[model samples]
Target: MPATENVHVWGDARPLYTYTRYIQNHFGERVQKLAVDAGLSCPHRTQGRLAGGCTYCNNNAFNPSYCTPSKTIRQQLQEGITFHANRYRRANRYLAYFQAYTNTYAGVDKLRALFEEALQCDGVSGIIIATRPDCLPESVVNYLSELAQRTYLFVELGAESSHDITLERIRRGHNARSTEEAVHVLRSAGIPLGLHLIWGLPDETPEMMLQTLHWAAGLDIQTLKFHQLQILRGADLAEAWQHTPEAFQLFGLDDYLEFLVPIVEHLRPDVAIERICAEAPPKYLLAPNWGLIRNDEILRRFEKMLLARNTWQGRCWRGEF
Candidate 1:
């Protein structure tokens, strides 16, 4: 039995707490996120590190065409705003989403310069930085803390999975402990925090995925993003899958939807879910081809399933009941 006061339903009848509601409540209106590529490289992908970076990662697969590192941050933001404007007409204010690679891999001075450049753009309200837990040194954390005080800021750490064994298999350089420490550090600094998790991975079972969500629910995070593992053409995981398909348990669309209901039900009510699925361009996608089905459609079907089952986020949360 969850506390009645803790239950929240968005205006659109969303059963779970959603990023849209969170944004509307915070900004008093719709605010779109314009993805920007800051031209920073991940430490894991750098020379002399892990050979192929994350086995499942191919940033280009998910990145918007407008988000190219060659373009200036301001230019990218402007283009993104233009691109999103047609779809999200209600969004006048925009948040610069540093989404491509590890955004905070640079020194404080350079990071500040790029962040400020986005803030200087027209209609830009805030910035969301995506980075790895291992990349956040004390210096970077302090700078992020300082930045948060001035304007709206959110730091999203790529936690991927809470299972160290799965993490090792994926070649995600940092362990689960690194994610915990990063969450604690960011929360202590009074920075709003978000976490990114991959649902289906090489050797993760549904129970294992639930354990990761349980771990996340206990964290001091404001938001979470869930990306179903997609086998992309150029990713190392694709090569591995080609050689040994039995090693992975990738989700078909309906199966993913079925799996997500319990996941949403177990999530803490306070944590806004930013995304529940990932959709890469068909050209880069190699497997689990749910043809022409978009993220919004998945969300719609998920919500319908939740309604049919008479459940919402935190329905099965141990902390709540």
Candidate 2:
């Protein structure tokens, strides 16, 4: 079974349904829509570092088939809605999740125009813009904040980790402070915010992960996604893995669960936990493959273990359970 957030389903513990709940709460309706990719490349990829994207980022890994750069915005929206609506016939609404590369790297006027265009689509309810923290401009921030006052808006930044060193090691280009400042600016403007976090980055110790979680809890972030760092083919991480495979310790299924439970508990209960793991294709995954067990399968095992051990989200955090 795939893990669901319904406490009744989990029986003893609560699994969270993140973005779904947040959107419903924000718009006061069920948000059973598809995330449409508006193909965009960040300036960081061209105007600067020119490095071959982030080490782990291959937008190809996540974008759905319905999302094609060649498709018109309307055509893409139609395709996405068709697929999702067929599966969930009852839902008639959607949020245009601009989720390919960096959705916020463009000029402010362009972002405003694209978002406005998305809203013009029939049945569309809101916008969810995903981008790198360093790439979100102040002008864009101001514009989005203003829009949120009248419409539902969320900005999910790839603040992958809290440590500067790990960011540099991953060729993330930006530092911890950039993420902190991004959240501060957006929150100050009254825009709802979401963040991306990777739990097992190379060279980051378990102690550091706990500290990072604590730091994350202290932020004004409203939502966060938890992901295990996965090494992808053709990524900078592939090269690192080839050279120092022994130096890296990939998490076995149970070990990763143990690693995450504490961080989850340490996290503020109010911050909606979006995703527990990054579900990559089997062909692309390198190791620790549990043969495609559903997310709920993992969650069931996790909750059983956590409870058997008399632990919850924050057990043994800061040397206190």
Question: Model 1 over residues 1-321: C-alpha lDDT tens digits?
Answer: 434444454434568888989998799998899899999978889855789799988989978989898999999998897898777675779999999889999999999999999999999999999999999989999999999999999999999899999999899998999999999999999999999999998779999999999999899999999989999999998998899888778899899999998898888888899999998998999887889988988898888998888788877776742
lDDT of all predictions, in order shown?
0.89, 0.75
Cα RMSD to the true fold for all candidates: 1.9, 4.4
The C-alpha stretches of model 1 lying farther than 4 A from their native spots are 1-12
Model 1: weakest 10-residue lDDT segment is 2-11
TM-score (C-alpha) between model 2 and the true structure = 0.87
Model 2: weakest 10-residue lDDT segment is 1-10
Q: Positional deviation of 67 in candidate 1, in angstroms?
A: 1.1
Over 1-321, each residue of candidate 2 has an lDDT whose tens digit, in order, gives 212342422122444335556556566677755567666777666776856767877676677778887876777888888887676556668888888889987788877777888889988888888888888677888888889998878888888888999998888889989999998989999987888888888889989888788877778888887778887776678777879888788777778987887776676555777777777777677754667887756766766775676555433334321
In model 2, where do residues sit more than 4 Å from their true spots? Answer: 1-19, 86-90, 300-321
lDDT of 1 at 144: 91
